[model samples]
Target: MNKPIVAIVGRPNVGKSTLFNALAGQMISIVKDTPGVTRDRIYADIDWLNHQFTLIDTGGIEPDSSDIILSQMREQAQIAIDTADVIIFMTDVKQGLIDADAKVADMLRRSRKPVILVVNKVDNYNKMMADVFEFYNLGIGEPIAISAAQRSGLGDMLDKVTEHFASLKLEAEDDDRPRIAIVGKPNVGKSSIINKLTGESRVIVSNIAGTTRDAIDTDVKWNGREYVFIDTAGLRRKSKVKEEIEKYSIIRTVTAVERADVVVIVIDAIEGVTEQDAKIAGIAHENGKGVIIAVNKWDAIEKNDKTVYEYSNKVRQILSFMPYAEIMFISALTGQRLYKLFDMIDFVIENHSMRVETGILNEIMAEAVAMQQPPSDKGKRLKLFYITQVAVKPPTFVIFVNDKELMHFSYTRYIENKIREAFGFKGTPLRFIIRERKEK
Candidate 1:
């Protein structure tokens, strides 16, 4: 489902990051006593009650500041404000209403968007409650007293924020196409491949648009089908991430992977697959996403007839865990075999959502058990009553056994292999859910 976006905006040192951390339930944004500590915009998914929305924490918007960094900060916050469905205008209760607060209030009032006035640093309820009323003179809305540091009165504030979502129309989700994410280490041609796919002359789908401020996601149509391409920041080595914004970008990359239905792991052809490449591919596989390894810059490599075979063997050896993933060699610069890559993504998506009937599943289970009886545990042979597929998008199956503890890992692997052989669920992971059968 497409969730509404909410932005937390305010001047420097008003505890915007603190309230953001409190609501997010983790330290996503770095909080400090120093002013203007947060320079980049940080995003997180927030689930309040039955409503869900994307929460963005932006750097302090110093509209009047002439400093280069502060001016850039203002621009970043402006982007958040323009993209957000609702805006949280936070203030400091101790500081009272200052000129800068009034200035920002005027700016928000003119924008005519839903603005929730939040009073932060209200450490004491009774002492700050009286002071919070002073913010009403700004003519925006009722000031909500909250102690982001103490983490109090957040439920009431969230109630007020979600109420506005009912009035705002969120972006519609596209269920027709597979959301493909392209991820790799830095300097891996992730961006180049996307640009090539959605070239100016290409049949780009302009119907569905992304609400995110970053234009990393592009929608394109190919072969009478739509595909949403999510371009992620190249995940850098931990030691190389020297700036705070780079750390936040890493979080964005994870969010992209979680939202994608299929993940295209791009690798450097000349460099081959490295440990970092394995790690990136592992994340997609572990998350149960249909994975495809695309070796970019293939044209740069001097290759013979056996060169492709040799390189593919090395890739499989490194990513042995993701045996289901298909490998394709392409050159982003030359657009070599680009059409084949798109077709492979569609093929994987079809298998990712593949489901087998219960009767067929049980048939496969019986044959597998007859061929090789489940391993004996202390002379108590394991008994699998039946098997049924419980879900898709990973093709999860449940095996009803006499005792769950008796289902050894090797036996489960054998069952999974049998199911894969019976039905071609290629380019997707198979998950076995073991359960103890209850006798009537």
Candidate 2:
């Protein structure tokens, strides 16, 4: 299901990152005391009492900073506010409601979207309680006070935030198509592949780089299964991109990858793999998205049978950690080996969407632990008692152990490797949670 989006917006250094970390349940954004530390929008999936939503931590909106960078940051935040289903108007109790805050509040009020006013840095009730009342005059709504740095009052604030999303209709229940995104650097033939898959000129194809400026979404059905394809704009280095539109396009591309079930990274067969390609693959791997490396323009490459094999091996060497991702060589212009692309995509999507029964999960866990016992930490044997699939659509599992602290990172990787070997969940990222088992 597509989760509702919540954007956090306020003037410079009002604890937006602190509030973002609290809501995302992780430190995805860098929290610094300096203003404008968060230059781009950081997005994460937030699960609040079983209801999930996408949270966007936007750069602070500074109205007076005529500096180019500050102006760009404000523009990015405005883009997020426009795209969000609900906006969290954050303010600082320490600053005591400045002129910039009022200007931003006016912008949010004109947006007409549900705005949840949050007054951050309220550590002492007596000292900060008076500042919250001043925010009410912003004309948004009742202000919810929170101390993001101390991690207090977030639960109540989230309860109010989710209330705004109560009206969003659930995504269509019966449709089970896996959402796949085609992402890569510029001039990598992303549009050509999408055109071939959809059998139409759905996207403009040009030899020029940075031709597509937004992530375009379309649906296609193959073999009685539906797949939503998102063709994203080519991502360039931060130095190369100077315009505001290109900057937002890059943000949208990253967000699209986070929301996708599988990410198909296209590479130029002639150019081979580059650092930017590795970076894009890393983003997919970190976000737990299924990855596929597509080597486009293969028909143009002067090659023998060994050429394809050698290049594929080089790609695997560069992306060693993501060995599970399948690599394919195809010419998007000539439709060479294009049918195979669909079959491979379908197989990966199935693996990505696979759900293991609880009993089966436990059985696999028992056998895996017995075959290769976890290393002893200080002479204490790690005992894994139970395993459960907490969620699907990439399949996250929680394992209850005797000592959660005793579970080493190497051993966790071992268990993940074993599960993949047994279940054949190729082209999918698996998440494991280690929890301590309570004494009986």
Candidate 3:
């Protein structure tokens, strides 16, 4: 089911971006004290309880006849309000509800969408309670007091927001198919690889940078299995992206990576791995997405097996931490080794989404512990009682042990390697959690 959209709108410098950052659980938007720092509609997935919604932090809405920049900002806010299922009409509690906020409130009231009045900058509950209540006169609804900077009262506000979108289901029921995002720097043949896998030119193959502005979604059926592929815009460094469109494109790419179950980082074989390539790979690894690096334009490289080996070694050196990630040498233009790329992707996706049974996990853990017991801390040996797969889509496991702190990083790595070796989870990263065995 599609997640409902929630838009945050307020007058200039009313902590819209701050509140957005708090709710998004990340600093996606650039939050400055200056108004209009958020010129574009920034989106992030907000997880509240079991409910998920798309939260959009739009530029402050100014009067219709304001300056060009403010007018553009107002236009963007209106666009967000129009697209939103729930509108958060944010006002400044410290500023005591200005005239411009009233004007914006009038517009939101006319919008007739579910509106939740948010009184921001309420650092003191007792002092700001009256100020928050004054917003009720705007005739939208009861105001929820919050301090966006301190991230206080956001829980109650989010609870109300999710209430509006209660009809929409948040999570996917079917867990078989994995969502893969094809991401890379500009001109690295991302579109070409996506086209080859899907067997259609769904995305326009262009040599130009920033050709794909928005993230495009497409489904591919390979080996009698379905996979969702998201083709995102070529992400450039923030300093290099001068245009507003390019900046937003990078934001969209990051959001795509966060949502994806796996990410295919494409690199140009001729150019070799650049710093930007490493940055993209780092984002995938940080997000715990199953990553597969594809070296495109392999046919154009002027060398034989030795060249491929040397280049692959260099790439591996850069991404040494992600040992589970598989690297493939493919020519997106000539389709050389392109078929193997999809096969590898499927293998990684399957491994990332695998769920190990508790009995099997405990058996593997027992064997692993017997092989090399965890090191002692002050003669207190770590006793691992059991292990269970807590989640899939990266295959997170929790190991119940006697001394969680005594399980050193090296010992934990040993258990992880043992599980991988026993389970054969190739081309996928695994997360291990060591917890103390509680006495009943």
Q: Which candidate tops TM-score?
A: 2
TM-score (C-alpha) between model 3 and the true structure: 0.74
- Give the winner by lDDT: 1 or 2: 2
* lDDT for predicted candidate 3 compared with the true structure: 0.74
lDDT by candidate, in order shown: 0.75, 0.76, 0.74
**RMSD to truth, every model:** 7.8, 5.3, 6.5
lDDT of 1 by residue, 364-426 (tens): 999999999888778887899988888888889998998888898879989988988988788
Q: Report the C-alpha lDDT of model 2 over 1-440, residue by residue, as the tens digit.
A: 66688878776678887788766655344323212213343666678898787777665233345455344445554666546778888888888977667777777778778889989989898877877899899988999998999988889888988897777664466766778888877788998899998899988777767766456788988878788888875432233343433344445556677658789999999898876677567667766787788999999999886997899899988877688889999999999997787788888888887888989888887888889988786788888888888876577999898898888877888888878888988888788889997757
Error of 3 at 75 (Å): 9.9
- Candidate closer to the true structure by lDDT (higher is better), 1 or 3: 1
lDDT of model 1 at residue 174? Answer: 41
TM of each candidate vs. truth: 0.67, 0.77, 0.74
Ranking by TM-score: 2, 3, 1
Q: What TM-score, to 2 decimals, does candidate 1 have?
A: 0.67
Backbone clashes counted, model 3: 0
Number of clashing residue pairs in every model?
Answer: 0, 0, 0
